[model samples]
Target: KATVDFQPNYDGSQEEPTVLPSAFPNFLVNGGTGIAVGLATNLAPHNLGEVIDGICAQIDNPEITLPELMQLIKGPDFPVSCEIRGIRGIEEYFRTGRGSMRLRGKVEIEENENGKSLIVIREVPYGVNRAVLQERIAELVNEKILTGISGMRDLSDEETRIEIELKRDARPQVVVAQLFKLTSLETSFSVNMLAIHQNRPKQFSLKEAIDAYIEHRRDVIIRRTRFLLGKAEERAELLEAFLLALGHLDDFIKIIRDSKNRDEARERLGSYKFSTATAEKLGILIRSQAAVQGDRYVFSERQVNAILELRLYQLTGMEQDKVKGEYDGILIDIKDLLDILAREVRVLTIIKDELRVIRDKYATPRKCPILAEAGEIAMEDLIANDAMIVTLSHRGYVKRTPASEYRLQGRGGKGLKGMETRATGKDAPDDFIEHLFSVQAHDYLLFFTNTGRVYVERVFELPEGSRTAMGRSIKNVLDLKPEEKIAAMLRLERSTDENGHDNTFREGAGYVFFATRSGKVKKTSLNDFRNYRKAGLTAINLEEGNDLIGVNLTSGEDEIVLVTRDGMSIKFTEGVYKKPQGELAEGEEPVEEDSGEEDSADEEGRPQIRPQGRATAGVTGIRLRKDDYVVGMAIASEETMLLVASENGLGKRTSFSSYRALRRGGLGVKTLNVTDKTGKVVNAVAVTEQDELMLMTSTGQSIRIRVSEIRETGRVAQGVKLLTLKEGEKLQDISLVIPDGEDSPGDDTSVDASEGESGSVTEETTE
Candidate 1:
């Protein structure tokens, strides 16, 4: 009792315990943060089960290596729900006792009803104030350094949810990157594993920290067990005395009855003796050495006093039996306690068993996932690079369906419905697919917007959906201005594992060609867009009111053609060489300079669309008439024919060979005669016989037709009507997907700018 509290109160009247004997490792499980005279401790809290397991593993094998211990201990598991950036910092701290560990708050990207994105914070780094983090982010946004975020709301209650609303032009990835760089969403913990060991302050490695706990536990258990064993032995001795006295109850009663008063009775009972012959005859032996005389036993002073004070009911037969049972139980308990105190291993086992019990009852699994680096996901390597068909709706929804979902349709038939277009409500207009293309799951796509900024997306990163699903919104995925829409999209092949895997046509192998709605064109090397931050960079500088309409990836020597809704079309080359003075453009071969003017029939040709700077608006490819705009652009050989379709479903197939390759910015020849009955030409596509076509009407009706069904005709001929429409319905869009045979994207064929990549011209541009 005197040792229990060694410290005296200020009044010197009371004592308090200075050292607490906690059964668990408080230092490790609870951790600590404090400043000392010359050093400071910034220890991270760990999971109780992990700490206990580490202690037990250590107790089992005292020489366990750090790595073996780490498998069980992992690292500090902060109570807050944030991820540790890597394991290297954990290893450093565990080995040398000091290191810097990075932690990032958890965030989820969600789309709002307004077709905007929200970065919802699921957690904040340990010890960071969510409100302060939000404020810091808001300040950054106000200062214009973090330009993407528009607003913020703190919805944190029991769980943290700091909702940051992104502007229509804000990229979620870029906004998140800015948050990490500028705010407390990401933080570093400087781990200093310092604590008290052996009655002195000391720094400890992982093994040493656990070892200290085990040693303290070992001492505590040993001392506690020793104290319990002493108690049990003392009680058993008294019980033995009581049993011996009960054995000779008649003599003890006689002696007590002969005495007059209690004092005299106690004295006389103390003097009373049982002869050895009598004891042996009674089948009793004394256990207390002080009470045993040479062949006889006499009651001691304390025993005699106990006998005088003993209640009469204790002498009853049932009472005496219960006393015997209790005494026997005590004897067993004493033996066990003695055994435990005798062996050091027994105490260690007891500690381990107790730790395991606590662990079994209180442990929880880790909440935070550890990663190799910030923002890097390791699962991409496991995703198969299967081909997928991606579609974008006019209302900004995007989804990827497997290419196998689409089956080939026979010629001149009503097309199968690929999607059920139920919008948000009845008041909302039904949406139709504006863009459709096929790409490998691992490929990268460059999205050029009407506002001239470019962004990128991995094909696999898109949400996969059923063929009949509505798909996710593009506004929820990419950062775009509210008024800006996708102008042109191009597929760039990038190996997901390029450094480790051998791949042909390294990323950025070709050139990106761009055409504007205002009859302008430009070509830039594809490699220029290979690297960019998530917010993206400017792909082209647009003149006011001159929006980008189309873009394609070219081989730097492909033939380029532009078609207008007014039925005028022109074809040119992308390469630059000497022109024939009057011969502004020519055929597939290199152009030869001619001295004579008006020399029109040159077999040789030069590239027309020169590669321009990334920020430059290009030269004109066609001269548009009033109220006329480019509807489609194609790259094809003169052997193919242009199939022009109008709003009334009237179409014409004109041979490309008949149209002369003129100077890039010329008034193109009429490909079809526009009449009131024929309506205006909506689009034109280069077609081969085996290719298929899909047409949509304003009433949401659609049909499929084969290109071969339309007979080839002269450039100025009015064509046949392909479909009959309802009273108010008109043609809305036209696109196509071909079977895997001749229409398959091969090395030699010209690519359709709309279908994307190096595929045969199978798409009539609607987007």
Candidate 2:
């Protein structure tokens, strides 16, 4: 260690060097952490070879910028193999010596031969204790804050490896995301590149640190060169004196013999004369070419003392030749040393060559992998974008399958098995598929319950399965109150803003029209319930015995049709509201209805009413009998046909023109003839000629028929047999499945039919 300065020991008996002169930048190579009086420092370690290479580069070009130097240095290299996200933090640290970066453990999902997957964490960030990390993860799992982990174990031995076993059917990626959010698997590293330079502590940028190392190496080269030069000059002078005596051997022997003591002999040799050959060589040997000083060889005191102390064994002829050769080599060395002291470029060259050697011997490959773009993975990234067939069973079970599972078949063909497994619930039900439609997984689904509450869930959150697999019960997903069930489900696509946002459309821009089982109807803006809570949000204020049954999205210009179980259907144009209706502006009292303009009916002789707000009980949508309640609701247009089906497998299609437009609170049309031969109306849907219908029975049998094959007739005509049920079976529910990329058929119009008309019915058979 080169002593910068000395300090007394504890008892003042010894001195110690304050700092050692390091050959390389120790602060940057093996980074340090320390806490001083009011400040602290944390520097990340770097690769040894990279540090050496950077020093050499700075020595070659002192004016290089930080960014240019960074190209050679890259970024910090740690011992543990982890991931460092992005270059922004590293660049800032190198430029100003202070910044922070995100570091994540290197993790991979491995699957064994049995198809069981394990989350394996192979490495962690620098300075992180593996035992502490394992403990933290276990604690979170025990607390149930992090889920899907069945068990966790610390398998670290020679290398760090933590294995997290997942339960069967658990989503691995989703669990990993949760782990990152809840545990210390991902963390940040703060960088503070502070060091002592020129006897003072100071912050150093990357380029400045490299420059400091270069200066230290330069000083070492100069001091060493000067010391060697001094020794070489002294040795050269003594060699010249000895060579002169050898050339005049006869005089040298006589002088030594005649002298009384060694001092007298040394004096005699110093004044001895030599031949012209030795004189010429002496002039060239001394740095200054002074003449031989009047035929006498003059030596300094150092050379005289050296000759007096010479041993007898070193006085042989072979030894004399060896001394002559050493003298010549010393002359060359002295000249080169002088050159090094005189030129700064030569010193720099020496520093570069030595650094290169160190780099070649010690450099290693990078351990941390830096990403270009870094941030937390978003929820959208984990969801696959595909058109999925979402099926909701009558028994409250739900699942999603790819749309490719079902192929188009001719009219009246036996439908492909929609759901192959049975669902168990109260009464051991067969769980016929009640609702089946295609929508993208990213879309939002609003589940309107019979209790007038709405629950929102993303399509992707539903359990995904194959066509034959029975899915999880919906009760596990939604927190439904006692005896509550989803009555109607609506799919809301993403709104357009280039970047999609849900329901960004303004209030009153669109409407969600609601219809209840007690023939109550209401219209509320689509944006009114956008901010729903997990438990659910109030969709409408229901009366004591009424429950929500039908919900549809409309632009406020379309026509609506409501059908009852007793074969009654009503069609009305969506009404517009003028005055304040529900929960009036803050503290206003409720106003009594005027009923003044002499209440009158519309052109079709049906009662007309103004629209009301969401909180108010709805106006009458249809007048129903005591034993009847609305069974189906749809938006109708002229080009579309209404497919009505009964419980005993009788079905028919009547053109939407067959229904006449009425005002709100009208129940004045027959959609199908309900009799002993044909049971009560089970389902009714507005469909296009190109669409297909799925008919399900109480016995778990289903059939697909095209809308064009069902003979279209007037609303009063009895329908034909659509499905051949067994002796004890009846139709349970029916759904209209639209093919992809087909425009909805029809123009807005309505037609009315007379009641009590009998018609012939034929039976259609399908295996």
Best TM-score among the predictions, by candidate number: 1
lDDT of 2 at 385: 64
**Per-residue lDDT tens digits of candidate 2, residues 432-453?**
6666656777776888887778
How far out, in Å, is residue 477 in model 1?
11
Worst 10 residues of 2 by lDDT: 747-756
Q: Would you estimate the TM-scores of all the predictions?
A: 0.52, 0.48
What is the C-alpha lDDT profile of model 1 across 1-767, one tens digit per residue? Answer: 12132577689899766566667778877889899799899988888988899899889999998877877887778888797886778888999899878899987788889978899999999999977887788788778898888888998899998888988877687778778878889999888998766558787998887777777677677777767766765565455556667887887788778879888887777677777666445433334445668877766676666667778898898987887788778767766777887888888899899999999998998766665462343323435677676777778778987765554443333344566542233357787666766677777777888889898887877879977778887866676656778766777665445455523235556788888888888888877775554666788999888877677878888777788877777777776533333432222223223323232223456456667668887777777879998887777675667788888766667677666665667666667667666678777777777666666666444455567766666666666555555565576666644443433222222222233222112322211
Model 2 score (lDDT): 0.70
